[model samples]
Target: MKTLALLSAAALTTTLLATPAHAAVTQWGACLPGQGVDPRQECTTIEVPMDYSAPGGPSVTLAVSRIKTARPEVRRGVLLIIPGGPGSPGLNRPSTLVKKLPQEVLDRYDIIGFDPRGVGKSSPVSCGLAPADLSLTRLKPYPDADGGIAENAAWSRRIAEACARNGGPLIRHISTRNHARDIDRIRAALGEEKISYWGVSYGTYAGAVHATMFPATTDRVVLDSNDDPDPRKVSRQWLANYAVGVEDSFPDFGVWAAARDSDYGLGADAAAVRKTFLDLAARLDREPLAWPGAKPEQLLTGNLLRETLLNALYSTANYPMLAGLMKAALNRAELPMPNQPEEAALQNTAAHAGATMCNDIEWPNSIARHEQQVKRNRAVYPLTAGMPVNLGPCAYWPFKPAEQATRISSRGPANVLLIQNLRDPSTPYSGALKMREAFGQRARMVAVDSGGHGVYLANGNACGDRTVTDFLVTGHLPARDRNC
Candidate 1:
C-alpha cells in the first residue's frame, strides 16, 4: 500500500499538457437519442485530444450533458457527477440522480455528467475478447480449483496481449490521472472557475485524483464507497478487502435467510443457515448442478451461489433473489441462469472495466504469491470462498503503473466529509477506516449503523444522509467524529 503512495506522488509531478483556452460556448439543443431525459437537459460533444501531451495528435469526442440550475438567484457553480466503472458512462446521470437532489442543492449548481475516456459515447476501446470471456462469472476474480490464480495469471496475460493488439494508444491514456485532466477540460468547457462533485464507487478514485491534481479548482467534493489509493496494491487491495466485506455483510444475509426459513425452507436458525450455505458450496465443488444460459458451459453451484450472494449484497432489495436461489438449490430443482444483456453491451462494459482497472495501476506478476494468499484466504474466509482475494487482468497487465499510486494527504482544506456504512459489502468499514486515517483531521467521518454500499441516498440511514446533505447544503460538518 505504501508503494501506491510513492507512485501517486510521482504521478502528481509528471508534466501534463494544458488545453488552449477557448471563448466559444457552443450549446446543442437536442438530447441524446433514446435517453428519455427531459427536453430541458442539454446535450453536446466536446473534442479532446487522445493524447493530452500531443495537442496536435488524433482526438476523441467526450459526450457531455447538463441540466441547468432552475433557480438563477442562488446559482453557484457546476456540480459534476463522476460515474464509476473506470468504464461507466455518466452521460445520462445528470438527468437521473441529479433530479432527486434537494432543490437548495440543485439551485446552487448545474448538474453535469460525462462519459470518461474509453467508455460510453466517448472514444471506445476493446480487447475483442470472445463471448465466453465476457461472462460476469468469468470476469469476476476467482481462484483456480487448487486455490491458485495460475489461470488468472494466464487470463491476465491474454487480456493484455489482446488489448495491446486491439486497444491502440488510447488504452495507455485511460489512467485516473488522465481522467482528472479530462475533468479539468470539461470544467474549462463549461466555463466554471471551480466544480463541485458527487463521485461513487470507482468514481471516488477519479474525484480524489482530480482534487489532488487541481486542489484549487475543487469545491464540495463527495466521495462515496471510496477506493484505497495505495498504488502498489491498487485494485488487488480492493479485491482482498472483499473478504472483510463478506465477513461484515454476510451476517445481515444470514439474519435475513433465517427469518424467512418458513417461506424458503432453508433453515430454522441463523447458524444453521450459515452452515447450510457453506455445506452446499462445498458439495457443489464436487458435483455442480447444471444451469442453462450460464457461461462456462455449466454453472457450479458454489460459484453460482457465490455470484448470487455478491450481487445480493449490493442492496437489501435483492435479498429475496438470494433466498429463492438457495431454496431452489436446497430442493435439488433445476436452476435457471439470469439473462445477460445484449452481447455488444456486455463486451463494451467488460472492455471498459478491464481497461480502467488494468490501466490504473500495475499488478504483481507472481503466480506463486497469489496462490499462497488465495489458499490462506479460503481457509479463513470460507464464506467468500476465496473469490474476493483472487487475481484479475492486472496481474499480467502489460504496462507498468503510469505513475505511482496517490498517497492521500490531509494537507488541503478540511471541507471534505466522509459518510460510510458500518457493513458495506463492496467497500467494508475496515477499508473505510484506512481512508479516514489517511484523510486525518483534514476531514470528519460519519459512520452509519447500516449495511450495503453507497452510504447516502442509496442504502444509508437517515442520520447518515442528513449528515452528508447538511454538509453539501450548508458546508458545515460535525465538529468531531460521530457514529449513527
Candidate 2:
C-alpha cells in the first residue's frame, strides 16, 4: 500500500554516449536536505537515457546516495537499495536504512540508493490533474453509488487526457524495464564488478527485472513483499490483486480489533468485527461524513474509509490510526486522515504510477470490460470493493508501451532470497508464490508467520529478521524454503 524509501542524497549524472555501456560519469557530493538525510550520507547523480530504445537521445537524472561502511577493511561490495513504488522517491533511503538495518549488515557494504527517473529530484513529471482527481479515493477509482462505473470510466478518460497533454515525452518512458536499465547505469557509474541488492514491494519487481536483465553482474538479491512477476500481466495484475490481498490481510486486523472491542467497539469478536467493517462501509456509502481540509468535494466517503483500512492494514503499529477513525466515525466525531500529500506531489505520483503501470503491459481498453471486472471483484472482495479493477488511466492511456515488459527468468543466480508475510494486504502470499515459481530454483523463500507489508527488519518477527540478516551478511541461504 506504501512505497519504501531507498536513497536520499545528491545524485547527479553527466551526459553519456549511446552504447549499452552508457559511458557516464559520477561525482559524489553532499546531499540536499530532506530526502531521508543523515550526516554520514553522500549524494551524487547518474544520467540514464529517458528512452532506452534511443540511447543517443536525451537523458534523465537519477539522484543517488550512499553511506559507505566505516569498516572499509571488511567491505564486501556495493549493496544497492531499490525503492518501492512506480512513483516512490529515492535518495533518502540510506538515512532510513541506517536506523533499521543491523550494524553488522551496514558494515559489510557501501549501501546505495537512487531515485528512479521521473521521480523525486530526478527529472520529475506530472499530469497537472485537478486536486479532486488526486485524492486517494479517486486515484484508486471506486465506483459510484449503486456500483455503476460511469464516473470511473469518465475519470479514467479525463486523467489520461490530462497526462497526455502535460506529461511530456519523459512520462512515456517510465516503466520497470527502464528502471532496471537506470540501475545498471548506476552500477556502471559506480565502477562495481558486481552489486548486491535489496528491494521491497514494487522495488521487488524492479530488482527482479535487474536480475533478469543482468544476472551475472548481480551478487546477492533480496526481494521482500514481492509482486507476481507474471510477464503477460505485470502491473495490471498487481492492480487487480488488491481484491485478494485485502481479503487475506483483513482477518488479522479483524482479530486485533475484536480483542480490543472494549476500547473501540468495532466488534466483540473476529466475526463481529468483520461484520462491523462491512456494515459501516455500507452505511458510509449511503452517507459520507465531513472532515477538515477535505474540501467540499472530498469527504470521508465509504470508499475513502475503505482506503483508510487498506492503508492501516500495512502495519499493526498503524492500526490505532484506523481504530481511532472508525470510533470517531461511528460516534459522529471528526478525525484527521493520514498522508494528505500536497496537490503537486499527488499529481506527480498519479502521473508516474499511471505511466509505469499502463506502459508495463496493455490493460483492457474497453470501459465496459473494466466495469464487468469491477462487478465481479466487488462481490467477491467486499473489503476492497471494486476499486482494484476501477482503474482511471491504463484503459484510456494515450500511448502503447515503448517496449515489452521484462519477464523475470529463472536463469539468474540462486542468490535471490524472498521474504514475505503470509497476510500482506498489498502483495499477497498467493502472488508471492507466483514470483517464487517464476524464479524456480533460482530463489529461496522465508515465509514469516506475521501480518504486515514489509517483513525483513520490519514487523518485529525475530525469526524472519534473523534469517534475512544471516543471508545478507554471510551469503548463505537455507537449503530450502523456510517458515518462520
Candidate 3:
C-alpha cells in the first residue's frame, strides 16, 4: 500500500545552464538537514518545464540527490533510482540502498534519486483536502452492502473539484511521460552520456517509457515489481489487479498463521485460520468497533480489515501484525494502536496519486460501468470487496490528459533486466509477465520464489539480487529469463 523510500541526498551549488528551461544544469550543495543523510550524499536541484510541450514556459524545480563512490577512478556512470507511487519522493532512496547494495555496485556508479515533479521537495501540488477525506478508507472507496457506489461517486466529484481548485497548472503535467522526461533532464544535468536505471513499482513503468522513448540514452535498466504496461489501461489496470494480487498473497499469510507451534494461536490449520478471519470480518461489518485516535469513521469495520490485510501482504514481515490484529479483534479485545500519518502528508500523497493517475489517461465516467465492474469483482474476489475496481478521483478529473500513455516497446536497446517476486501482493507475477512481454528480447526477468511488492535488496531472493547487481556492475544480463 505504501512505497518504501530509496532516496539519498547530495548538497547543492546552483549554476545556470547555457540551455533553456528544458535543459537546466544541476548545482551540488551539502545535505541541508534530514534523516539518514550520508556525508557521501549530495543534494542538488534541476529545473524542468512544467509542461514539456512548452519548453520555454515556466519551469518547476526538482529536488535531486546522489551518493557518488569514493573511488572516481572506478566510477562507471550515473545510476538513476526512480521511485514509485508517482507521489513517493526518491530523495531518501540512496541512503537505504547504500547499506545493502554490493560495494562493487557502489564503486561502479553514482546512485541518483529525486522527488518526481509535484512531490516532496520538488514543486508540490495539494488539494487542501479535509482530514476526514484524506483517510485511506476514504481515499480508496469501499462500496455499501447493496454494491452501489453512489457515495463513492459523490466523494470522487468532491475530491476532483478540490484538486482542480488547489493544484495549479503543475498538477496537469504529472504524467508518466513527463516523469520520463524528467529523468532525461537529470541525466543531462549530471553530464552523463548515458545512464543506468533501477525502477520499482510505478518507477518501473516510468523507466520502461524512458527506455522506449530514449533507448540510446539508457545504459543499464532494471525494472523490479513491474506493473502491466497496457497503454489502453495504465493505472486503471494496476488498480484492478489489486484484487487478483491480494487473492494470490492472502494464502501466504494464512499458511504462516496456521504453521505448527504458531505463537499467535489463531488456528491449528490454514482453513481454520481463514475461517477465523472471515468470521471476524463479518462480525465487524455488522457491528463496527470503536477505534480511539483514528479518524474519518473512527470505527473498525470489515473493509478496514480487508484494506489492512491488503497492505500487510506487501511484506512478509507484516504477517505477524495482521495476525495479532485479528486475534485481538476476535477476542473482543482492544485493537492494537494504529500508526497514523500527518494530515498534510496524507493530503500530499493523495494529491499526487490523483494527479499522476488522472493526468496519465482518461478514466470512464460511467457510474453504471463502475458499478457493474465492482459487483462482478466482489463476486469473483470477495477478499478485496471490489475496492480495487471502485471509482477514484480520476473518474471526475477536470482536465483532459495532456498526452496519451506511453506504449512500451521492444524498440529499446537490449539493456533491461527485470526482477519480480512470484507472488507480489502489489505487482503480481501475472502483471510482471506483461511488462516482460512488452520489453520482449530487450529484457530478461529473474522470478524469485518470494511474496512481496519490492524485489531487489528488500524482499527478493538473493539470486535475484545477485543477478541485478551483476547487471549493474558488469552489464551482463542472463542468457535467458531465470527463476530463483
Q: Which runs in model 2 stand beyond 4 Å of their true positions? A: 1-26, 295-297
> With candidate 3 superimposed using the best TM-score fit, by how many Å does residue 396's alpha carbon deviate from the native?
0.8
lDDT of 3 by residue, 267-306 (tens): 8887787777777877888888887766655888888887
RMSD, one per candidate, in order = 5.8, 2.9, 3.2
Per-residue lDDT, model 3, residue 316, is: 82
lDDT tens digits, residues 282-338, model 1? 777677787776654356557657766776787787787777777777778867455
TM-scores of the models, in the order given: 0.91, 0.95, 0.95
Q: How close is candidate 2 to the true structure, as a TM-score?
A: 0.95
lDDT of 1: 0.73
Best by lDDT: 3
Ranking by lDDT: 3, 2, 1
> Which residue ranges in model 1 land beyond 4 Å of their true spot?
1-25, 295-300, 336-339
List runs of model 3 lying over 4 Å from the truth. 1-19, 22-26, 260-262
Each prediction's Cα lDDT score?
0.73, 0.82, 0.83
Q: Which ten residues in a row have the lowest lDDT in candidate 2?
A: 3-12
Better model by TM-score, 1 or 2?
2
Q: Kindly give the stretch of ten consecutive residues in candidate 1 with the minimal lDDT sum.
A: 2-11
